[model samples]
Target chain A: MKPVSVLKVLSIGLLAAGLVGCGKQETSKGELIVKIGSVAPLTGPQAHLGKDNENGARLAIDEANARGVTIGGKKATFVLIGEDDQADPKTATIVAQKLADQQVKGVIGHLNSGTSIPASKIYADAGIVQISPSATAVAYTAQGFRSALRVMTNDRQQGKVLGEFAVKHLGAKRVAIIDDRTAYGQGLADEVEKAVKAAGGGVVAREYTSDRSTDFTAILTSIKGKTPDVVFYGGMDPQAAPMAKQMQGLGLKARFLSGDGAQTQEFLKLAGPAAEGVSASMPGMPLDLMPGGKSFRERFNAKYGVIQNYAPYAYDAVNAMILAMEKAGSPEPAMYLPELVKLRFTGVTGEIGFDERGDVLGGAITLYHVRNGRWEVLDTVQGESAGKSK
Target chain B: MDIFVQQLINGLVLGSIYALVALGYTMVYGILELINFAHGEVTMVGAMVCLAVVGWLLGLGMAVPWPVILMLGLGAAVVACMVLGFSIERIAYRPLRRAPRLAALITAIGVSIVLQNVAMLVWGKQYVSFPALVPVVRYEIAGATITALQVVIVLLSGALMAGLWLLVKRTGLGRAMRATAQSPELAGLMGVNPNRVISITFVIGALLAAIAGVMVSAYYGLAHYYMGFLLGLKAFTAAVLGGIGNIAGAMLGGLLLGVIESIGAGYIGDLSFGFLGSHYQDVFAFFVLILVLVFRPAGLLGERVAERA
Candidate 1:
C-alpha cells in the first residue's frame, strides 16, 4: 500500500507539471509578447455579429503576426485576449476591468454604444486605448474620454441620411418611429426624429420596445392607427425580422426603415419574403466599392463564412491600432495615443482618420433597400451632405 | 375604435398561447403543490425540437405537404417534451417528494437552470427563425386584420382548453389525480396508485406546454433558447393571478393579462400624456399581479384551504 501511494503521488506530480508546461507560452528568445483585447457579446442574441467583430480583429492580429511586427526595435508577437460582455453594460465594465488587469495595451470593442459608453470610463482609467467597431451613439464620443474612438459613422450622420431619404426621396409625410430603447437605438431614433421634423415630415407616433422583446404586435398595431407613410425602427435584426413579418401580417401599408443594425444578411434570411422593400442605412461605402474591401471580404468570407455587418470596420479598427503602435515605435497605450489620433490610411472600409473628438473623419452613410431578397445599394451620402441636409 | 379592435384581436392571440402554457403550471401545481419551474424550459425544448425537426425535414427535400411537415415537427416536440417532463419529475423531484417544500422548490429552480444551459448548448445562442410553413392569409373583420394562422391558434387553444377542462372534471384519471392531490397516502390506500397519477399529470401538462410552445414560435416567427425564460415567467404570472392549481382561472387570467397588456401598450402614451410609451407594457402586467396579490391573496379563483404540511 505504501509503494502504491508513492507511485500515485509521483504520477499526479508528473501530470501537474505536464499541464503547467502546456500552458507556457511559446516565444522566441527575445520576442516581445503584445496583448490586444477584444470585447463583444460573444453569446446571446447578437452573438453572430459579436463573433464577426472578434474574428475580424483576430484576422488582423494573425496577419500582423505572420508579417512580423516590430515595436521599439524588438520583434513582437500580437495576441488577442477576447472577452465576452454578453452585450450588457454592467458586464462590459467588468470585462473592461478584466482586460485592464491583464494589461492589454488596447481594446477593440464593447460593441454596443450602451456597453461602450459605460466601459469607456474603465478603459480611460486604465489608460488603455479603446476603439469600437460598430457603436454609433453620439454620446459615446461626446463623453470626453480620450480612450474612446469608433471606426463607423455616428448615428447623427446615419440617422440624418435615413430621415432625409424617408421624406425627400420616399415622399413620407408623417413618419412613425419605434426604438428598442437601447442607447444605440434610442439615440439613433432621436436623431432621426430631429431630421424628420427638419425635413418637413410630421412625427406621428413614437413607441419603444426592449431589445429582448420579440412581440411588437401591440406597438405595431398602435402605430398603424396613425397611418404614417413610413415606419422607422431603430433596432437590430433579431427584433427587426419579426417586426417586419408582423407589419405585413397586420397589413400595414407603411414602408419600413431601420439603421445599420438591421443591415445584415441575417435579416434577409430571417425576415424571408417580408424583407422585401425594407430599407436601412449602413455607415460606409458598399464593400465592393472600398479600396481593399473586395480582398478583405474574400479573405473574411473564406475564414468566417459570412461578413455579418461590421467585420470590415472591426478589421480596420485592429489595423489602425497596429499602425499607430508601429508609428510610435512602442506598444504602450500612452506612447501610441497621439499617433492614433492623427493616423490616416486607406483601409478596407475607406480612408480612416479621426477628428479631434476621435470621431472617424469623412464617414459616408449608404442607404440600401431589400430587392429580390438582397440588399441593393440605393444611395450614398457623404458626411458633409448628410449633416448639411438637416 | 379600429385600433381598439385590432389590439383586442392581438391580445386574444397572445393570450391564447399564455393560457395554454399556464395550464401546464397549474396542472403540475395542483397535483404536487410544487412550482415545477422547469415547465417553461420544457416549453422551450418543445419549440427547439419542433424547429429542429422542421429544419431537418425541409433539408431532406421531400415532397411532403407543409402542414404534414408542421404536424411531424409538432408530434416530435410533444413526444420529446413528454419524456423530458416525466424524467424531470422522476429524476429531479421524486427524491425530494418527502423532503422540505423549500428543498423541492430550490431543486425545481436548479432543474430549470440546467435545462436552459442544456438547450443553449444544443441550439447555439442565436435566434432560430421559424420558417413560414403556413402560407399566411389575412382576413378583415370589424376593421381589424386577422391572419389564418391567428384564427387557427385561437380555435386550437380554445379546443385544447376545453379538452383539458373535460379531462379534469370528468375523467377517472383526473379523479385519481385529485385524490392523490388531496392525500397521497389516502389515495395509495384506496388503490389509486398515486405515483402513476402524478406522472400522468406531468405528462399531460407537458403535452399542453409543447403545443403552446409551437403556437408561440409560430406566432412570433422565431425561437431562441432564452425565449422560454420570459415566456415561462409570464405564464407563471398568469397561473398565480388566476389562482395557482385552478384550470379555468388560468385561462381567464391569461386572457385578461394579455388584453390588459395590449390595451395598456396601445394607449399608454395618451394615458400618460405622452410621458410614458408602450414599453411600459410589462410594468402593467406586474402591476396587475401586485394588485391581485394585495386584494385577493387566494387569487381570483382559489379557495382558502389549509396548508398540506
Candidate 2:
C-alpha cells in the first residue's frame, strides 16, 4: 500500500516536471533562430568528402553566430540540420523531402551531381533555396532552377581543362576513358570524350563500370591493348584510388586522369604512391590560395582534421546565403531568395555571384597532379572552350 | 593474344575471392539445406574486425612486425566470424528449422539486413581503408604482371581448397557431417550428434569466409560496410554455377566465372559493335547463367537432387 502511494506521488511530480520542462525549452538567446539544411552522403564511401562539406557549413554557422549576426532588428542564431543522403539519388530525394518537412530557411548541399540533380526539383517545389558546394555535373545547373546554385564550375569546364591538359601538356596522342556509368561520372566522361574527339585525338575505347565495382582488371586489360598514353576515369576517389593501383598492377603506363572526385588526400593514401604523376582537375581556386583559406584551414583543422577538397566551396555557399540574408535584412528564405540570385560578393572561394541558371559567374577550373605523393597545382584554366584546348 | 592473357590473369585473381566466399555458401547449404543469405554479412564482419584489430595495434604505438599484425588480424577475424556464425544459427535459423522453408529463407534475409545495419552502426558507414600490410611487389610472367599480393591470394586460396578437400575426405568429423547432411534423423539414430556436425560445418565455413574477407580487402586496400553485398552475390552465383551443394564444383565454378567475366568485359564493346560496353559485364554474367540453366538445369556439377518432403 505504501509503495503504491509513493508511485502515485512520483507520477504526479513527474507529470508536473515534464510540463515545466516543456514550458522552459521554447525561450532562447536566439530571437530568430533560422534553420538551414545540409545534405550529403555523410555515411558512405564518399562520407569523408561529405563530412568535410558539412563541417564547412557548420563552421560558417558558428562564426556567423560568434560575429553577432542580426536579422530583422533581432539577434539571430543559425541552425544547421545535417542529413546523410548516402550519395544515392533515391536517398537524396528522401533527404530533400525530410529537409522540406523541417521548413528550413535554406539548404546548402546534396553533394554529388547525381544527388543534386534529383533534389533540385524537390527544393524548387518547396521554394527553398538550395546551393550545392561540390556538384560539377553540367546538367545540374542546365535544368534552369532558380533555387539551384553551385559555387564550383560544371563538368563542361572541368572536362575541357582535362582534355587540353592531357593532350597539350601530357602530350597524349591517344586517350582511353572509363566511367562508373553514374550521372556525374558518365556526364564528365562524355564531356572529355567529346573534347578529345574535337581536339583531333584518337578515342581508342569508351568503357564503363558501376560505382560499386572493385575489380578493374577486365577493363584495364581492354584499355591496355588500345595502347593509349593516357587513361581518364570519371569517378570518385574510392574507385579511382583502386583503379590507379590496379593499373600499375597490370603494368599500364598510361597517366590516370579524373575530375575533382579523385583529387584528395584519401586518394593519395589509398593509391599508395601509385598515385604519383596522376593528374586531376577541381573547380575553384586552390585551398592555400583562397583569400580566407589559411585561417579557415587552421580553424577547420582544430575541429576536423583535414580538408577533403570541398570545404572551401561549402563555406562559400554558406557565406553566400548569409550575405544574401544580410542584404535582405531577413533570414526568411523567401525574402532572401531574390537577393541570392543577384548576389555579388567576394567569398573565400573567390567571386560569388549567380547567373540566371544559378551558376557561379566567372567560375574557374584548376588542374592538379600528384607529385612525390603529394598534390601540387599544375595550372588554372578559365573561359576555355574544348575546341581551343591549348 | 596479350589482352586475352592479361584478362585471364585478372580473372583468376578475382575468382579466388569468389571461390572462397562461394565455398562458405555451398558448404552451409550442403549441411543445412538453407541458403544462409547473411553469409555475405559474415565476410563484412570478418573484414571489419580485422581492420579494427590492426588499427588498434598501430594506434597503440606497438612495434609489431607486419606478418605478426597480419596473423593477429586474421586470428581475430576468424574468431569473431565463428561467434557470429554460431549465434546466427542458434538465434535465427535454428528456431525456423522445423518451420516452413520459406520462413527460414525470409529469416535469413532479415538476419542479413540486421547484420548490415549493426555493422553500419558499429563501424561508421564509410570505406575504412584497410592499411597496406602486404608489400606490393611485381613480377611479369608471359606478358602478364602479377603482384606479390595477387600471388599470395591465388596460391593461398588454392592451398585452402586442397586442405578443405582433404578434410572432407579424410576426417572423422567429415564422415559425421556427410551422414548428417544425407539424413538428419538417420544420422541421429546412428549416434552422430547432428547439432555438433552442423555447428562445426558453420565454423569451418566462417573460417574460410573470414580469411577471404581479409585477403580481398587487403588486395583492394579498402573495406566498406556494404562492400560485402556485391562480392556476396558474385560468390553465390559462383556457388550456384558450380552446383550449390557440391564442394569441388564451387572452386571450379568461381575460377571459370571470373575468367568469363573478365574476358567478356574486355571484348564486349568490340564484340558487340558499340551496342554494349564493359559496364554491362555484370549483365553478361547473368546472361551466361541463363544460358547455362537453359542447357543444363542441374548446373555444371550438381548431382540429381531428390525431392524434399
Candidate 3:
C-alpha cells in the first residue's frame, strides 16, 4: 500500500511540471510583440482630426499583419497602441515620454503642430522614428530631428502655392494676410507674406486672431479698409469659416484663400454661401483624382458613416512607415531610419519618396475651390518643379 | 464709419450670446456660491442633443420646414438639459451641500471631465454640422448687414433676461431662492425646502445655458465636442466682471467686453507688436477683468454689503 501511494505522488508531480513547461512555451511564443504607438488628441476639441489619423495608422497596421510581413527572417506582427494627448503641448510631451519608455518601434501621429513640435523633440531624444500625417509647421522638420518626418507638405509650400495663385490666377496686386495665432497658422502666414513680396505683390495688411475667438468683425473691418484684392488665411477650418462669413458681411469682397487645414466640409458648412470662390491648397493626390478614391470613399462612408478629408495622406503615411520597416528587415526604428530615407514606393497619395530633409520630395499640392458648396480641384503643382512653372 | 458700425453691430450680436451664458454662471454662483464647471459641458450637451434631434427628424422622413425643425430641436435640447441639471444637482452637488467649498469645486471639475469623455465616446469626437434652421437672410440696417439669425439670437437673449428678472422679482420661487441664498439653514427652518430651491436654480441656469448653446450652434453652423470650453471661460470672465453674484451686471459686462474685444482687433492691427489680433483679445478681456477687480471689486452693480461680508 505504501509503494502504491508513493507512485501516485510521483505521477502528480510529473503532471504539474509538464503543465508548467507548456505555460513557459506559450509565454515565449508571445514575447516578440512589436508595438507601434500613435499619440493624438483623442479626447478634446480636436478629437475628430486625431481619430482620423489614428484610424489611418490602425488600417495600415492591420494590412501589414494580414500579409504576414517577416522581420529578421521570422514572422512579425504590428500592434498599435494609441495615446490621447488632448492637443496640449504639455500632454503631448508626457505621452511621448511614456511611449519612449515602452520602447515602441515607431510612432505615426500627433496631428496638431503645437503638440507635434514638443513631442517630436522627445521622440528624437529617445531615438524613436515619428511621422505626422497632418502637422504642417515649417519648424517641424527644421529642428534637425532625423527621425521626425511629416507625410504632409509644409506650410511654406502651401503658402507659396496660394500666393502664386493669387498673383497669377486672380491677378491680385495687393493681398491681406490673417492668421489664427497658432504655430501652423503664423508659420503659414509668414510664408505667404514672404512669397507675396517676392512675387512683387504688396501685402496691404496682416491680421491675427485666436483659435477660440468667434467674432472677427473688427479684423474684417480693418481688412476691408485696406481694400486688398485677396485675403490669405493661415488657420484651420473652424476660424477660417467664420472669418469668411464675417468678411462677406462687412462688404469685404476680397477672394479668401487658405491652406490644407481649411479644406474640410465643415468650412463650407460654416461659411455657407460665402464660401463660394474661396480656394484652399492641400497636399497629396486630391480625393477626386485618386485611382481607388471612389471605392475608398464608398467603403469609408459605409464603415464610419462620415466622409474623410485627409484620408489618402493618412493612408499613405501608414503605408510608408510599414514599407520602411519591411525594407529595413527589422522592426527597430533606429535600424529602419536610413532604410526609410532610401525607400521609394507607390502609394495612394502618389509616388512616395523622402528628400534629404525627410520631406516628401516632388510631392504636389492640389488647388481646390469651393464651388456650389463642394470642393473642386483647380490645379496641381509639384513642389520641386514649382519654380520652373513661370 | 460704415465698417465701424457694422463691426459694432456684429460685436453686440456676439456679445448678447455671451451675456446669456454668463447669466447662467452668475445666477448659479449667486445662490450656491459654487462655480458649476459642468455648466459649459451642459451647453455642449444641449447643442449635441439639438443636433441628434434634427438628424432623427430628418431620418424619419419628416419634411417639415426648417423653422419648425429649429423649434423642435431647441425644445428637445431644453428638456434634456433641464433633466441633466436636475440629476447633477441631485447626485453630484446635493450631497456636498455642507462639504467644503473646495470639495464642491473639485467635484464640479470631475463632472466636467466625465461629461467631455462621455461625449467623445458617444459622439465619436467629430465636428457635426448643426442644421440651419433660420433662413439665411441678411438685413441691412444703416450700412450694417446683420443676419436674421443674429437678430433672433439677440432678441431672444434679451427676452430671456427680462423674463428671468421678472421671475426673480415677482415669483414665489424667486423669493424662496433669495431666502435660501441669504441663509440656507434659516430658509430650511422657515418651511422652505432649500434643496428644492437649489434644484430649481440649477434647472433655470441650465435652461439659459441650453438656449445660448442652441443659438450659438445655429449661428456658427458647427457644433463640436469642445465648443463650450472657450465660451465657458469667457462667460465666467464676464460673470466676474459684472460682480459675479449680480445678474444685471453680467449682461452689461458681457456686451461691454465683446465690443472692447472687437475694437481692439480692428484699430489695433500692429503686426510688429502683435497687439490688435484675435489672439490678444483674450488678453485684453483678462486685463479689463484685472482693472475692474482692482478699481471696483464689487463689480459695476454689485451690492457693497454682500461683497464685503
Give all candidates' CA lDDT scores. 0.88, 0.84, 0.79
Candidate 3 CAPRI assessment class: acceptable
lDDT of 2 by residue, A1-390 (tens): 345434533563454345345433224664776777888876656778888999999999999989988776677777777777778899899878877866677898888888999999999999899999988888898988888989888888788778878888888889999999887888889889888877768788888898988788889889898999999999989899989988987889898999887988889878877888999998877777776889889999999899988898888899899889888988777899999988787777767777777877767788899999899998877553212321
The DockQ for candidate 1, computed on C-alphas, is 0.63
Given candidate 2, what's the lDDT at residue B115?
86
Q: Of 1 and 2, which scores higher on TM-score? A: 1
Off by over 4 Å in 1: A1-135, A146-148, A291-353, A385-390, B306-309
Worst-scoring 10-residue span by lDDT in model 2 chain B: B300-309
- On residues B1-309, what C-alpha lDDT tens digit does candidate 2 reach at each position? 878888898899989888999999999888888998888889988999999999888888788899899899999999999998888888998888899899999999999999889999999876788776777788988877888888899999999999999888899888888898899889999999998888888888888999999987888888888878877888888888898888998998889888889889889899889889888888766776777667765568988675731
Q: Candidates' TM-scores?
A: 0.82, 0.79, 0.73
lDDT of 2 at A314: 88
Which numbered prediction scores highest in DockQ against the true structure? 1
Clashing pairs in 3: A210-B279
Ranking by DockQ: 1, 2, 3
User: Which lDDT tens digits does candidate 3 get at residues B142-184?
Assistant: 7667777778888998899999998988998888888888888
| C-alpha root-mean-square deviation, each candidate | 7.0, 7.7, 9.4
In model 1, pairs of residues that clash are: none
